[model samples]
Target: MILHFLGSRGCIDQRSSRHWRHSAMMITQGRERILVDCGEDWLDELDSLRPDAVILTHAHPDHTGGLERGAPCPVWATPGCWQSLDALPVAERRLLHPGQPTAVAALQLTPCPLAHSVRAPAVGLLLDEGAHRIFYSPDVAELSDPATTLRDVSLYIGDGASFDASLLRVENGNLCGHAPIPSQLDWCAAACVKRALFTHCGEEIVSGSHEEMNKRLENLGKERGIEAALAFDGLEVKF
Candidate 1:
């Protein structure tokens, strides 16, 4: 399985060479391609992308705004995401039941519910291709079940909204917003995940020096006993 990062910037005005566009990832296995999210940055570029299928993590504009003009292929999302995207012109809509693994483009995807936005609601995806497993959650306040969701996962791709300070806020008593990188590293360490990469970069990462941030991330990962780094646009990883 190969992972291609199309964009890494979060929903913010700050932009750098590495994190210029909105967060999105493309997973490819041979000729089959599955796009994880299509943000506003990719609105006019979908035709060229020509993905076999698109899997959305949530309905936030940064995650689903590209489908405003409709999609060329099937679009998959959780029930809650569908509710928020009902007005969109997406032709083929597929339902992703939480915790139920579904095969798309030869990859098994399991949607694990997450606490991020109260209005939009979100889920982290568990991607498996028999030999390797990866957990991807670009925006998350907390995972519903980190232990179960990350079990046997070799790589964890998570939110980079903040490095150490929590971005969470109490919204009607429910947590909302992205979790800090340090906390996510703690989760990875708890799950024994050895490799981790963070995308959906916030202002802290986008406006800071990449070299400095890389060193900080490496040091933070060392403290947690995990190897970690920041993911950049156009970066590709194979497993």
Candidate 2:
């Protein structure tokens, strides 16, 4: 599986005036594409790829901007996410309830409920193809033990949105409806995740730099005896 970050910031999409990079994420699940969140003006991101499906964990504007465009495709969302989209006229919101398994692009999808400000039933998706299982939860508030949720997986791509983001609110420069960095680390201790990636970053992160976040995570891991990785816009991983 290949995942490309089309937009990684939490609140808005901005271009690096100097570097000129975008903040959208594009995940190519074995050639077929699945867009995680469509925040900001991403006309190019949507029109460019013939996405097989669009998955929305919640209905935050930054997470569902593309739905406003009304792309002629199936939009898979939690019942809350569907409600969030129902506000839109063109969006044909389909149901993606937590704890239920479904199929998309030849991949089996299992959604796990998560905690967040919205309390709108955030989900952790477990994408499987026979033997490979990829557990993904991009935005969350706090994580419980692994037994009832993400316990074992080949890869865990979650709301590592930023190093210290979950602490602050979105309007106050936080990651909005998600957990703080330390909370996630505590949660990972129970899950045997081969690899962990951070996405849904904030604008401050762009200025602080991914390298700084990596160093912080490395230090945190060493201090706590665990490892985690920062999710970049163009990061790719193989299972």
User: In terms of lDDT, which candidate is strongest?
Assistant: 1
Q: Candidate 1 lDDT, tens digit per residue, 1-239?
A: 88999999999999999998899999998789999999999999999999999999999999999889999999999999999887899989999998898987688888999899999989999988777899999999987667777999999999999997778998999999999999898889888999999999999999999999989999999998899999999999998
Q: Write the per-residue lDDT of candidate 2 for residues 1-239, one digit (tens) a residue.
A: 66666555565354343213323455676668877666545554577767777777677666677667676577787877676566565555577778889976655788877666453456777777556776777777665556346665656666655566445354433244667666666666566454566666655555666577678876765554566766666566655
C-alpha lDDT of all candidate models, in order: 0.92, 0.63
Note the residue pairs that clash in candidate 1: none
Query: Which residue runs does candidate 2 get wrong by more than 4 Å?
Result: 12-24, 165-176
lDDT of 2 at 165: 47
Q: How much is 24 displaced in model 2, in angstroms? A: 5.1
